[model samples]
Target: MSLLQEADRNHLINEFQALTEPVKLVMFTQEMECQYCRETRMISEEVAELSDKISVEVYDFVRDQEIVEHYNIDKIPAIAIVRGGQKPKDYGIRFYGIPSGYEFSSLIENIMMVSRGESGLSAETKAWAANLQEPVHLQVFVTPTCPYCPQAVIMAHQLAMESEFITADMVEAIEFPQLSNKYQVHGVPRTVINESTHMEGAAPEPILLGKLQEAVA
Candidate 1:
């Protein structure tokens, strides 16, 4: 059974046809004890089939220790979106669970962002990200059903793409219960910056930037 509907597949094909450059979806999964690893890999493969410029690489988290360390993958069912070529362009964009529901749109947007080598951020926000002296980590906790979660995820990803010091992750709260519990993610679209600064809802770019500034300050 295909994970994507025929209409969705056709739409993605058209959307991915605009890719100016190739994009690679790198997925890490282990064979045992992983709930959604297989589905995650399958989704990556299915999406890659939409465009000639897109490709998927699946790796075992346990066996590919070197590659795992290289990408800094710490969990199963993880995805790293990189620019495709002889060399991988790691923008530090990641999805820590199956990107179903609203997050599926986020995955597509991220692919386009990387393929164009553009973050689509405002000049002010870009400047802020470029001058960051300290590392920042953003983890956006979301459930698959949340309509507003994708906005939070995409905003963090744009910052990640703009700045080397930033790493953004979209964490499916339902899939990773322990993380949700640790972070006290009782609501949808909860964005935790640097594990300290927390934003409760889908914030606009300016507000998110303010939260980032607060995290580093």
Candidate 2:
């Protein structure tokens, strides 16, 4: 059976109806002996096919040295989203691991929000978002089995998609145990903003935004 059933496919297609501008998903993978790398490419392509405004571009990590350096992609099987470039640029958003399970939904919604150039934030939050001057790095550590992890990942990804200065990543905690140790991720849905501020569980959008702002401050 496919990962997404008919009902799920229909839901996603319906969701794509809201997108506006163009968005590109850039997949970086090595040609040979890459695990879950092919799956990432396939998932990005399938999702991109759902909407005319979104497209996918695959790059060999081993071959694209300049792009890898430009995007600061230190690892393979990375996926980045640029506004509308076949080649990912300096300020593109990055995903370090496979965004499977609930994270998959987060991925799709991110593309939609970015394409629309809008966020589901209130007027007060929008004002704060408008004032963002510095870059914010959000790392949401998650395990696939955690029921509440998706919420954190979705919120972070949404913020990244909404703001050019914010880049969010849903890090699979199990896949990167060293990251977990480095960040001291003993729980699910633990978000580390800019390597200094950390918050656990799925926080409300406003609260998370405030945390990000404080991290920059």
Give the per-residue lDDT digits (tens) of candidate 2, residues 101-165.
77776677678766766667677766676678888888888876777987887677767655668
User: How do the predictions measure up, each by TM-score?
Assistant: 0.97, 0.85
What would the per-residue lDDT of candidate 1 be over residues 120-217, giving only the tens digit for each residue?
A: 89999999998998999999999899999999999999999988899999999998999999999899899999989999999889999888888898
lDDT of candidate 1?
Answer: 0.92
The 10-residue segment of model 1 with minimum total lDDT is: 30-39
Best by TM-score: 1
Of the candidates shown, which would achieve the greatest lDDT relative to the real structure?
A: 1
Residue 140 accuracy (lDDT) in model 2: 88
Q: Report, for every candidate in turn, its global Cα lDDT versus the true structure.
A: 0.92, 0.77
